[model samples]
Target: MMHHLGKVALPVYFWLFVTWLFLPLFVMAAMGFRDSNFVAFPIQSWTTDWYQSVLDDREILASLWVSLQVAVLSTILGLGIGTPMAFMVARFHGVWRAILITIIVMPAFIPIVVSAIALRMFIGNFGIQTGLVAIAFGHAVSSVPFVVVMLLTRLNSMSPNLADAARDLGADEFIIFFRVVLPYLSPALFGAFMFCMLLSFEDFTRSFFLGSFDPTFPVLLFARLRFGFDPGLAAISTLVLVATIALGIYAERFTRKRTAPAKQGRLAASGDDKNV
Candidate 1:
């Protein structure tokens, strides 16, 4: 009886955990269709008025556009900075290698509030009063570590002989990178890009600290939430969630297309080498 109770308890706990994790999102999504101005249970008559209100608000529209711009720019900057760092860390080992990795990963380990405040001060002290510039800069710095960590893991898993083989065949660095490394790293790159972009879009702390009057969508939504719970905000959230899910699926498919052939060939070659 005790043993059966334990088994039943585990499944119950697992279902409870899953429910707890998604219950808020489910409630929030429900509020988007709920007909009340306030987010409440027993969600009153269903309507599309909340979504229309989101579209009608100029501030919401502007903030959402800014969020997209910032996310795109920050992710692009992270890609440029993270690729070289990942390549170097994965390829080289020295006294400085660990230090480099620690530095890159420290942002992720540190409290995001602390990072936001620190970035706000640093950028402010430079006399940079611009909103988007500060926001994008903060996002790029904070997100670079995520890109480096993911890309480095992918790079480390790759065949070391590939670069050497390319060099032996008289392929230049650019050719080898475009032909071999990029194909292998496509999935990691896609994941990193999407992660950074989504983070930038959803980040409230840094956006709150970095922007003066022009806050990103999350920051703006939070500010509004302080007044009262708005069903329109729920509508915005549901839209963002749906869009992000769609984008993630598209990116996964794109990554698979780029990685499939290379992955099969590499596995075949690796098996042949082991057999030899």
Candidate 2:
């Protein structure tokens, strides 16, 4: 009886949750079509002129370029550093492992504003000025913890026997890692990459403190909002939402492809053994 009640209630709860989550987004999307100059609750009529204006704005374009550079660079650096660290933590058993993992994850707990301020002070002392490089470094620091956690979860789910079998077959360490481990990890890596990209793109506090001349997307958006809310901002947000959803779908497909074949192969082999 309880199970049936839960099943019936689940759909209603899910719809409520979805509506709660997407209400603001829907409002923003609606505002994107407003024909008026000022931002208003009830949009009069549909118009795409604001989107066109945003497209023609040189500052927005430049800010987007800067944001793209920072997000890409930060994701690359985070992946390069975090993946190995995750593997070590997942596979190794030692006292130092926990300590090291905790240290790697500490950055996530640190407030972004505090981290940004510390970086600014540290870099200033070394005569390193704020710009794209500073922003990239700050983003990398913040993003690496997430990458580590995601990759660690993936690594933990993998069977230890697979790695041992690879070693017994005389595969070298590099080849075993690349062939046996990386394929299973691709989905997680893609997820981490997308998360890092979104975080870097949407960051504002760090950018405000560390961004000197080159501002990121969020920083630019904040500046635009200060002047007054524009319909173009809504359009840009809608684009971001669509892109994120598309990336999530692609990652899900990739994960299914990677795991499905192995399961099928096992089932086929089991059936063959039974026939014998």
Candidate 3:
């Protein structure tokens, strides 16, 4: 009775939610194949020329390249800053840990538009003109909190005995970090790397505020939308959306694969420490 209804309702709700989320994306992808120059209703014909035209559009290509460079730069900066912050936070306990985490992740709670404006002001005061470097820095600022949280989750699960074992082997802090801590953190680090890149690439407000002459893909897309929509725009968007999804899937699989060996190595090291 109720159980049967619950079971039926659950699957129905799940599929409904999935459709609500992904149906638009599917529609956008379909729009790319439309043969007409304009984006509109039922496809009378289909062609790949829109996708090809995206390749020929130098402005689109240049903006995409800018987005890629910003992604890479911001991810590097986020990882570097977040790794040390995670380590520092891990050393604290109880209320102190809570306080530290609150301060570090506060940026994530701030409104994006406000944060972007504040960052722009901060950089301008230092005489840093808005451009590629400024955009990368702004992205990094937003990404750091997420990186810290991700790394901290992995860091908390780590066995302190592994570090102790390395120290017992006459390894210094630097050596232990490189040989033990870093290898253990590799999966989380890799996941963070991909996450920051994706975050920076898709971000609009921060990139928009931080950029000057050069625009990122999202900013450029927004600018073009004022003129009107076209099949070519849809084609480029569909391609980027698909690539992002594929990269996300790859990151998940790569993290899972790396997690197993990292755990095994940590256990083996712990055993060796006991024997010694």
Candidate 4:
């Protein structure tokens, strides 16, 4: 009875959670079509002029380009550094592993605002002035920890015998990782990449602190918000939300393609450990 009750309760809870989370966004998106300069409720009529203006704004375009550069640079850097770190943690076992785990998970607990301030000050002391490089580096530093932790979790859940079998078959570490292990991990890696990219793109504190001359989209948006509401910003928000959802759908499809093998491995592991 409890299990059945839980099954129904969870869906209801999730639906409510989603509704609450998205209601504001729906309202914001609706304001884009509001036939007025300011964003307000009871949106009357409909128009796409706000979206049209967003495309024409040179400042918005420039900031969007900068944001794209920073997000791409940060995701690349995070992926390069994080993949190895995750593998090391997942496969190795020692006292140092515990210490490394602590280090990787610590940054997630720290606020982005706090990290932004500390990183800016640290870079400044080293004569590294704020700019695209600084902003990208900061984003990578913040996101790498998330990639490491999440990837490590996924890797740990994977079957260990697959790696052992690959070794026994005379497969080198590189070949085994690329050919055998990577398929299982591609989903997690892509998810982490998306997380890092979105965070870097939406980041305001780090960009405000470190992006000296080339302000990012979020920074520019905040500046514009200081003056008053523009329905164009709502249009931009709607577009961003749509892009995010589209990326999520693509990732889900990409991951589903390779999930069968992971499931089979889980079944094999379950059979092998039947006594447990």
Off by over 4 Å in 2: 1-13, 256-276
Against the hidden reference, what TM-scores do the models get?
A: 0.87, 0.84, 0.94, 0.85
In model 3, which range of ten residues has the least summed lDDT? 267-276
Using lDDT as the measure, name the better of candidate 1 and candidate 4: 4
Among all candidates shown, the one with the greatest lDDT: 3
lDDT of 3 at 122: 95
Per-residue C-alpha lDDT of model 4 across residues 1-276, encoded as one tens digit per residue: 889778998889999999999999998888888889877778778998988888888988999899999999999999999999998887668988898888887877888789888999999888999999899999998899899987886787677788788899999999998987887787788889888988898888899988787799889888888998778999987887898788877877876666657667666764564422
Superposition TM-score, candidate 4 onto the true structure: 0.85
Judged by lDDT against the true structure, how good is candidate 2?
Answer: 0.81
Off by over 4 Å in 4: 1-17, 269-276
Prediction 3 global C-alpha lDDT: 0.92
Candidate 3 lDDT by residue in tens digits, 117-223: 99999998889999899999999999999999999988877878988978999999999999998888989999999999999999999999889989999999999
Models sorted by lDDT, best on top: 3, 4, 1, 2
lDDT by residue for model 2 (66-133), tens? 99999899888988988887977886668787888889889889887899999988888888899998
Model 3, C-alpha of 269: deviation from truth (Å): 6.2
User: TM-score winner among the candidates?
Assistant: 3
What lDDT score is found at residue 121 in candidate 4?
92
Tens-digit lDDT string for candidate 1 (174-251): 999999888778888988998889889888888888887877888888988888877888998888888988887887
How high is the CA lDDT of each candidate model? Answer: 0.85, 0.81, 0.92, 0.85
